[model samples]
Target: GLLRIDHVGIAVADLDEAIDFYERTFGMRCVHRETNDEQQVREAMLAVGPEGGVVQLLAPTGPGSAIAKFLDRSGPGVQQVAYTVRDVTAAAAALRERGLRLLYDEPRRGTGGSLINFVHPKDAGGVLIELVQPAGA
Candidate 1:
């Protein structure tokens, strides 16, 4: 079934500013940063606590990025919740069998070397759910 909470995505207008806020205000540390050109977003991950779960700071990198659109529509805020799974494809299949609405018909590449699928917000009670399986997991 579910493995663990993968990450909590916080949409931001400025990645560096957000990172600094988390670091200085919450004593978190940036652990990873990656730019996804395909998604047109730059993401910086900060470990939250002793458990080391991360808060992903996302900034739109291009004019047409989905994050940019989201910010335009919703402003900077929490975006989506990601959960780790043992097998993303299998998880998607199970959810489909249960008649849950999925954003992706099949698993697709996600950040941090994971296979990911999204459950539609309408089906998930207004919360966008992301199923992620780490590469080689």
Candidate 2:
């Protein structure tokens, strides 16, 4: 079964600037930050509303990265919506069975130590959707 909204991914030109804006404007403190080399992104995770909700600010590490391409095409903004799931692989299989397009053939390691997969935006009404299974789950 679906658990909850894990996080909302926001692509930013600068991770530091975005973090500062969130901290000053919304009083949100960044709980974690890391550069994911495999994903080619630097991200900061900010908890929100005390309900296990998180805002993930993402900045591209290089020109060829997905975030960088997105920024070039559409500018900085929401990139994806992630939902917590008990098992990401199972969820992805089910989605595939339902004829949904998945970006990855298998789950990949994502920020915050989660196994993640992406649903194609065309199949998700133009909004990128991510399924995440937390570390150790």
Residue-level error in angstroms, candidate 1, position 5: 1.1
Estimate TM-scores for all models. Answer: 0.93, 0.96
Best by TM-score: 2
Over 4 Å off, model 1:
none
Q: Give the per-residue lDDT of model 2 (tens digit) for 29-112.
A: 799999989889999999885665789999999999999999999999999999999999999999999999999998999976
Model 2, CA-based lDDT: 0.93
Global fold similarity of model 1 (TM-score): 0.93
lDDT (C-alpha, whole model) for all candidates: 0.89, 0.93
In terms of lDDT, the best-performing candidate is 2
